[model samples]
Target: MNKPIGDLHCHPSFKPCNNPDISDIWTYKKNIHPKDLFKGILGVSPRRWMVNLFVKDLATYTQSNLDSCYEGDNRLLFLSIYPIERQFLRPDRPFASSTFVQRFILAQVFGIELKRHIDSRIIQILTGFSSTKVVDYLKSVYDSEYVDYFKTDFSLEYKYINQSHLSCSPNAEDNVATFQLVSNYEEYAALRNQNIIAGILTVEGAHALGEYNSKDLVGDKMIDDLSEENKEKLKASFIRNISALKDKEQFEFTPFFITFAHHFNNLLTGHAKSFGEAKNKSMPGFSNVFNQKNGLDLGISDFGKQLIKSHLLSRHNGQRILIDTKHMSLQARNDYAAIVKALRDEGDAMPIVISHTAINGISTRAKAAERLDTNQLDKKSYVSRWDINITDEDIREVFDSNGIIGVCMHDGRMPGGKFKDLLKSYKKRWPQKEFISKLHTQMFLTNVFHIVKVNLDHIRTLNAQIPIEENRIPEVQAWKTICLGSDNDGIVDPFDNFNTASTLKDFKTRVKNAIDMNFDPLWKRFKILDIKEENYRFFNENEITELKLGLTSEEIVDRIFSDNIETFLSTYFVRAYLEGTEN
Candidate 1:
């Protein structure tokens, strides 16, 4: 039996961008007569087979086509309910380009041709519009088309499970997997016992609340321009959206955490620097700049603080929705941490989480010394220097608050600079194409191994720097902070080896191999370091038993795969019971 794993962050509903139909061309080519007739046109041997077969396989797993989940036993998925940003469908450069060639590229290459079906006038109206307009457009499409599409593909034994169900246990006897909407740890545990996939809902951006836009002319106005009536209207809309999500009788898809900011800024918070659509030079007609100027370095505004106090931190049907700090600007992050700390000091505890992140290893002193005044700099000046990765201070804050940090799987985040170092070493050892082809299978696995090794080494180094009595944090406790958050189908370029959801099944074997290969060497180095230190303590009997007897590998893999995340959920949801339930 395959061991079950959990992905704390993923976009299972993002199929339009990762369309499976794009692979049909390759499938058709493979069926052509003689198969060798196109050997000259297409490369012969393995390259041809790779282009035809492997590409098709990649397509099938990239999209949330239902079969992708069953391909691997993904038991717990924190599924993101996203409203595709309107910038893609807008008919302008900063939003989108309506040129003939741009349309062709979007349709034939990128699989984002839905705007072509809509009226040109409507597309123009959507361009450079508020997030409210974009959300309304998305909701209409979701209700009319996308909902039914998902049901049809995921139906089990000819019976379609209603999407509105607060929780479901679809029959799994027909070689298809079951999906259950789980809100709390109790529900998650129950679903896992039945071997059903438990999906916890999350929202990618607060723009789904329907009253914000990154490029609004308000600029620094900060809600002061709104009349009393308009303020009430906006508040009503926000409440209505939250009520809809929490409605148990209807769509019970309330978010566990909402990322307040994304590629663009919204009314609720400022965003960190994110690459614009211009990153794809192939589509030069489309401008990449969105909210680059307005919300790049600004922290939480006064209106944002009010919204959090009045709505976000308040209970929704006896449960409070948490905030995700994935896309928050550095200033925003600091403000949020301070707010959470203040709340805790006042006897109200809220756990902090960064759903998908990388470690920057930036020291607290260095970060404090840098100037954060954005007004003096050009719009593009700080784009490259923006620190999106969590620093040591951020990690300590999360640890102290009993929070979890999910390590992202993208090449840009996970391995960061380590990937280049590993690639260099691999090329030096194996210079031939055939050898490199064989090595590609293990590349992602090796990268993950190195990431964990580097993280552990950093933790040990930090521990050595601090007095043991002052910093009582155990090395193993820090390891628990690392959880899997594969942002699959979120427009990320996946690691070469672990290209899709299905490849996760093989990740277990690779993790085991990594431990076996590095354990003895690490232990020997630790022993040598201990000899030079005063008041050195030997490895505890439990540690020796766990490492020498193979228990360490099992425990570490278990924690990273599912155990730690489950514990986090239990901790987070248990607060509702401890505090009085809101009526």
Candidate 2:
């Protein structure tokens, strides 16, 4: 009777079965398999209904007909061997085999070697563009008819860029490199497929050292860091890049979730505070803290603050934006809390999302690996949020601020079976009626609604509890909206399940069965048999009505089935259904 009724976090790798007949789904678990990870391009039978179901990439998205969507696994399932850097994203240039000579020729097409002049004028590098050289590189990629699709994902993910990196300059070594290229030459090479109607261009990190005051370069006068002419030249270079994307090719340059370093602090800090922080940047090139020589004031806490300032520059552009917090720090998370308040103060409703991350502090250990799909025959090392390094107070800070956090699938300290956890955590934290009554006169200045509470933690400490007539924030208001925020392909083989990727059969069997079970008998002496589906309606319909998210219980059901995830995502990512339409 005490079992929870809803699931907030689950990966769609499996099917969620709500049918009330098969209560003990362990019998059906045998049907799910690990190889299902290759469900898309490999062996997954293409079911027609699978059309509207693929997880839309949170990055760049153009008008897409689900029919055209090659619903490949989100993870890098396989990579081509012949290509130097081939993660066969699409059946593009990398997928095609080329002779070493051809690869050499393609690489040698653009031989522009760059260097830094003693002039502190770094912005001039943008004007260093060449029509012939740029055009030649573009031809090398598309000239071969072997490509299935030439995909161009441009983001100067500099972590992979190092001394062997041809795009960067050797002369710029002595002085700090003003900027780093996100995408290497190959990605840009495949961009202008004049025949290919749509390509994608993205602005990576904001680490580029532009003159602080951009507007001052308007005239043919001298500016502060670079000459006014150099500033103008740099501005022109960026304009050319944008022009090429929008005008020359019908590429949709919808940029979202762009950041210099995903977890910037972990990268900036030379010393690792934790094993997780050690591998902050995927590419390990030149790195040092911003100190006096870097012409910046330094502080212990400023690293977190600086990351926010850099992101806010793009966020404040007045072009309705979705701020990304994937690599942001807890200090920065706290800072963003203030930023959101100030934004709401100004009446801005632009939504934001932390696209990828497990519930903080959940993966208790560094290497807690669980096979994505299991029939519950093996030991389950479930991770609790308290186990993750991040504190409970930090989670409260985020939720209290009205931010939505997604449950990631990859293994970590965070626990699975989110449907039950969602209700358990809410009931645990709710304030009691007596405490609310005593504080109501002072807290809300009125004896309005009573509070009902249960403590999940420190169970023995909470005793002699009595039921209250009403609940906190009025019976009309409780945290009603819990949405699925799954990371399908970040890690594990073929990805799956509630806390992981799951096949349709696995979802219905394991995740649904766990949620439907009556855990009230779990504490008893005899073996606690899981109740059959006919025994309970699963969710308490009355409490469901009392819950609030400005939507009815029927609507909540719709959300639990589908809508909420869309609404939470619509706040940040563009929906596949509306890719062609304007935001």
Candidate 3:
């Protein structure tokens, strides 16, 4: 049996449907239906057939949905708690508009049935709603009543797992797996010991904090232009928002990390350049949306720096929640790293994390800029320049801080320049169909394989850079930094073969196969990389031990899939608590 897998980042709550009872809609997919008759003849369930056929939303995908976690044997997940931005739901979007033609298009494209009560006037009101109003609406959803309902419903529907439990209780049935939300390393270990699926809570965007509008104002305005009274109000609102997030009883949620920025510019920090029509065109209201003017190319503002110092960097009740650097602009990332380094110099060990990301081999701004100047940038290098991916410098910083980086599975981030070529081939072969059958799966597998190889190469590169005799960081230590964090249900274009969470099981097999085929050749190439012999002058006894236990391909796969991140959490969180740094 394969070792249990953990996704360091995913969003199960970001559903396409506006229905309050979204859980019911997901549950309904599991119910046997009359439509299963034809599928039954082919030994496939109707739900499975539909999922493999027409379902494009990540929420409906097997591994992404709550029920499918058990089926897929994905025993651990970092559930990203997010409040949808109002921009995507604006009434001007074709699907959100109420005209008969627009409604018809919506139904045809997304299979959403429009009701008569939802007319153009209602949509206009919703679209015109302020970000403040949207924040209030989301707050209600996270309130106790809704939180309790969500927890209870999931637990009742999936009897083997109890969503409300923070630690595992032994099950009388051998096959049953308990699911629990872990707040710290101890709780995580306790659940894992009993074969539980641990769910670690994280926030996708700080915009969910309800200070978006105020933050935006502060970002855009000069202090001289704003009234003292208004500035005071903004300050108060920011504090209140932070207080509410820390209020575990009222919200029933506390995040381990909050991604400082996302697709849009949040008031707190400047976002990375994640904008493009090709990426957002499929979503309603997002066709022409871009992040260029709204905090793009900007770094953290004065207010943002203070906000981080007071909330994220400061301990509350003896605990500090780290900030994730996934969506921050390159300047913002550099600013954040400098701040963290300053703190470390002052005897603080605040670690840095890229919760979900891919690597671009370029380590410095000079190198990246030179590649861009010559128009010789690889896809990954271009992506890194855009700040959507990590650079070698960032990876090294993460390693120095003893922080883990979760490898994202989104096709855009994954290595390989084959997707465009594959698309061309598919379009030529099957002009009448949107995609050539089975080709998506093949391309997805190929992309995943390339991702694995690139990550391994990154590890080797880091190893080569380190002074060999100093710590002589074992190749395994670098390998331990890589782990799965498939951004499913996070508005990601998932790899085609591993399109949904449920498909992760098959991906594990493919990973193993790819390793078998590519590991030795890659190792040979790594061994030949030019390095100064002085780095290995005084190799120590401990270094010799690690070198002898040289990681096997299977062991590396196991670490990436399960052991590494688990170890990271245990070491980081447990140390935080023991050192009196955690609340």
Q: Which is superior by TM-score, 1 or 2?
A: 1
Ranking by TM-score: 3, 1, 2
The ten-residue window of minimal lDDT in model 3 covers: 527-536
* lDDT: the better of candidates 1 and 3: 3
- Which tens-of-lDDT digit does each residue in 346-433 have in candidate 3? 8777777788886554555335434321112332221223346666667667766777777777654543333345555656775544
Error of 1 at 531 (Å): 25
lDDT score of model 1? 0.51
Q: What TM-score does candidate 1 reach?
A: 0.66
Cα misplacement distance, residue 268 of candidate 3 (Å): 1.4
lDDT of 1 by residue, 1-583 (tens): 2457888788664442223332310111111221332244322343334223312312223433234555556677787755555443433322344345444443332223343333221222222222344345545433332122112221210121234233332323454445667667776766656746667777776656654323332244334345665545555666666665555554544568877777555545777765422223344222222334456666777667766655666663435778888878787888888889988998776778888765544444147226442212112221112256565666667766777777666643433223335444656985655333333323333323323434445566767778866565565565556577777766564555565666676665555554544335533321211110112233433433333333466676677777779888887755463233523
TM-score of every candidate relative to the true structure:
0.66, 0.37, 0.68
- Runs with alpha carbons beyond 4 Å of true place in candidate 2: 1-253, 256-318, 350-352, 360-401, 413-481, 492-510, 520-561, 569-583
On a 0 to 1 TM-score scale, where does candidate 3 land against the true structure? 0.68
Error of 2 at 455 (Å): 14
Clash pairs (backbone) in predicted model 1: 92-96, 93-287
